[model samples]
Target: MPVEARYALLYSDYEVTPCLRIPFEKFAFLILTLPLCAFIFCIIYSVLFHFESATSTHCHVYNVLPSISAAIGNFSPQREVWQTAIMLQSVPRFYIAVIYLQFHHAMAYPRDAWMGNFAFLLNVTENISLIILSFWTSSRHYTVHEKAFITFILMSEFHMLLTCIMQSRFKRHNRRSLKWKRRLFLTNVSCIILGAYCYMRHNSLCEPYMYSLFAFAEYVVVLTNMAFHTTAYFDFENKDFVLYKYGAAITER
Candidate 1:
């Protein structure tokens, strides 16, 4: 069958399903704002404890801008603050995974296409990997932490790639506003490239600046991921998911 016909059948099935649908705006807000706030809090928390006059001499000046993971490690004297910041960050990640899965459902892509389902899977996997890395301090579980970090990066990139592909196929009316999507895609790709370079420089050359450079790259990656979700605001501005009340008829708002 033609792609349009397949999409039509899938959408028809979605229309009859008795599940509650949420507004994409809600998801977009969760995806974009929460993470931004959480990261900002984490950065501030990290910077404050890192530069304390009491600890600065023992911790070294370079330690002031340690990798985000290092800043949030369990060994910090401010472990509680760092852990709290990490937990706050994780909330948005969890919500992002949920929103991506919900988005896949809302799109009603055919099973055969599989891109939507796979994108959700990758997104969830990325979140899980990050969660693992967050709690499993690198000082104690270096190998596991490193593996989880790498896995998160790989899965996140794959998730974004699939998202870009799927978004490109949006109905004609929605595709026009996706110019920003292309720019975001490029930004993501550039971050990955720059991040890889910085990582290599830090590991191979032991360059002092490369450590901070890599950390900044990681921050950019997170920001770009958040930006990717912002594109949905344009695509779903007018459409909303219907919420079904328990023991009551479904109604669209």
Candidate 2:
């Protein structure tokens, strides 16, 4: 069967203007903004109100920024804001994952289609792990939260790497956006390494500002990850998210 015939099976022959249609750019904006605002809110709230606990570590080292868990785990409004953001963002994220899978598979060709699908799986697992970690705070469900966080980090890093690799293979696939995505992926990986080192050193020596370095690195990792996702805006620049009634009459404009 032809591709058009396959698509036709999913939709009716009638034509109608969508009741709700949002451009991918606008949708991507929401995807980018929610977490960013939550991150900023949680960090500022932690610094201003929950300073001692937020920046504290096992070794009692002084810190500049709080770890993501510290900022959003135990706090009241901070936790709530973070949870709300994640919950809201999750729906669009799943949609974006499906879109990316199709986009990658179609553009990269069937020979490497498995890579695209695997990347999609990684994206979904990463999102699920994020949701798990957001709800299960280390202060409470320590083991569960820790495991979820580790999974989230691993999945997120690998998803970014795989996505960059897939994009690099497509000769005409938005080279400028791919350029920034690859750059951000490298920076994200660097921050992850730096954060790990700082965390280990802080625990071993109980240094004054080592935990701060870890916190800063963690923040950079998050920022770079967000920036990488932001490239999706360019990826689907002309696309629209539509919700239309399938059998509705086509009214003349």
Candidate 3:
């Protein structure tokens, strides 16, 4: 959200960065959104894992449906475990959206540190998702696949929040040097750590195919965000970071 707000300010002809003509804009953005749409679909799929639960999850989902569809696509969560499993992604993602918005607009004003604070609570939001899902699933034993999927997403969100904070701190360093090797190393390291954690947490569980796809999407997005940061001059070294990064920042604008 902050990124969108910033893009509005920065790219608007009336604003800071002014405008630059981008080529193949439509195709490029569609490609970028495809991964995000997949990630979102994975979340909706998780919600489907839990069809019977204490809370309907359906009500909230129904109410939020149009908005979600507008943001991503038509994917919806139908089952209780799916509803429960999905919260692992949906809840923390809300924070990510808000923080991204807050950060984007924050450039126009420094007081938007609220984004940072919101980011710190990522673990809490994720845990809350876990608690709700666990309680719901415990009512009826969840599949090992569901359990592992939940574990992977929860861990990814926790780690993504860490990456957000770390990246923000790098920006604070003034230069925010663009070193693909450095960035890729850190991101891959994050992936390895998250994979290892998931392995440790659910060694007995059967890994879901959906979760593998989700992990792949998340890995790609980490690289995408780096590309985004490079374009925003949120990083120092000017490289030809893929234009797809700007697509994300531009969406909510």
TM-scores for every predicted model? 0.69, 0.90, 0.26
Report the lDDT tens digits of candidate 1 across residue range 199-243. 776667665556667778777777777787677667556544343
Deviation in Å, model 3, residue 63 alpha carbon: 25
Off by over 4 Å in 3: 1-28, 49-181, 204-253
Worst 10 residues of 1 by lDDT: 243-252
Estimate, for each residue in 80-199, the C-alpha lDDT of model 3 and write its tens digit: 333544444444234334434444334423554554455446544544544444334432454643574366455545545544455554434333433443464466556656655543
What local lDDT score does residue 137 receive in model 1, on the 0 to 100 scale?
Answer: 69
| RMSD of candidates 1 onward, in order | 6.3, 4.0, 16.4
Cα RMSD, model 2: 4.0
Task: Give the alpha-carbon lDDT of every model.
Answer: 0.61, 0.81, 0.39
**TM-score preference between candidates 1 and 3, better one:** 1
Clashing pairs in 2: none
Candidate 2 lDDT (Cα, whole model)?
A: 0.81
Model 3 TM-score (2 dp)? 0.26
Candidate 1, superposed: residue stretches over 4 Å from native? 1-27, 52-64, 74-112, 239-253
